[model samples]
Target: MPSVDPAASSMYTNQAYNTTRTTDATSMDKNGFLRMLTAQMSNQDPTSGQDPNQYFQTISMMTEVEQMTNVATSQTAQLSRQKDTNAQAMLGHQVSYITQDPTTGASSTATGTVASVQFDDTKGPSLTMADGKTLVDPDSVTSIQ
Candidate 1:
């Protein structure tokens, strides 16, 4: 009896099984796919050759995956821009945010007019008040008025 490679066998099981978790554009490039194709070709048996249709199917699946990734990235960027625009519109308007003063360390009310809104890469949004104090979370506001 001849031994079989489990990885090679799994490749033919389902198209979904081959999908890799590549969220970024760089990770889903042509070179990465070429490497995968090469690996599949190398592992295939010489006597029982892989079907040419399977090769084409794999390429089609990869193209679909890349398209889906691009769509998701575009949607995310649009959502971010919308959020920033909404935040900017809130400027000069009173907005409530749940906040605990760093100095006081007490649950007290701090209400001020909105001076400006700032968005950070990791921190999301920060609302700067007329009193020169910056509030990080929007939920920290007790009252908008």
Candidate 2:
């Protein structure tokens, strides 16, 4: 009977499976997860194969996360659209809102008619008064007439 050494086996002498870190440590995207799964599959031991059920479960989880992320994004976009619509509807109406002095750093309340609405991605909706000098934040509005 001939003895076969495990260390000299051809199955264990392949290259190491190294997956590069493309994303931050806290979170991994779907593409990163797929790349990692591929690497793992390619390097797994042949004799004792990985469970098919485990692979299916991991894929399912990834799919669920992707769907949830899409849903959240859609909800955010819908909310933004609704806000824009609401801000536009305030046109030709008088609104009372808090105002602050830039130099004196003093806060006061002011009333103005909504002349126009500006949609800013970073600032959201800003209402330009009839005077066109004052810019009012939609959130700062206290009363509408």
Candidate 3:
């Protein structure tokens, strides 16, 4: 009986998986670029140093990344504050909301005045019913009076 070699089969599979593959560029933040620059400086050949233009280009990229990060952070905080203001207006208003139990697949609707609002990093804003039940989905409000 003839035997199949495991090493030969593995080589064939690897070649099939890697065939015709083109490398895609991965995104790097400012910190990653800085680390890369540090490594490049430390490893450069003493006879011929790295180009000054490349160093300046890396600094420019880092500055742009920092500015973009600051803008994104400011915009996020502004949106959060707007949501909180809107939710605050719901307090003391009679509202109806729907809730579903995940395990039982049962649903129910409750009516009450909004007792308070809850805030977290992830959710937009949660509403606490007068009965103490909290609703996370703001759109689930069926009626607001």
Models sorted by TM-score, best on top = 2, 1, 3
How far is each candidate from the true structure, as Cα RMSD in Å? Answer: 16.7, 20.2, 17.4
Off by over 4 Å in 2: 1-26
CA lDDT of every candidate: 0.67, 0.80, 0.72
Please, what are the lDDT tens digits per residue for candidate 2 over residues 100-143? 99999999999999998886544567899999898898889999
Q: lDDT per residue, candidate 1, 80-110, as tens digits? A: 6666666666678777666666798776655
Tens digit of per-residue lDDT, candidate 3, span 36-133: 88898999899997788988997897898799877876776676667667777889999887889999989898778898877644455778888786
lDDT of 2 at 111: 98
Model 2: residue 100 alpha-carbon error in angstroms:
2.1
In Å, residue 96's CA in model 1 sits off its true spot by: 1.7
Name the best candidate (by TM-score).
2
TM-scores of all candidate predictions against the true structure: 0.61, 0.78, 0.60
Candidate achieving higher lDDT, 1 or 2: 2
Per-prediction tally of clashes: 7, 0, 0
Give the Å shift of residue 26 in candidate 1: 17
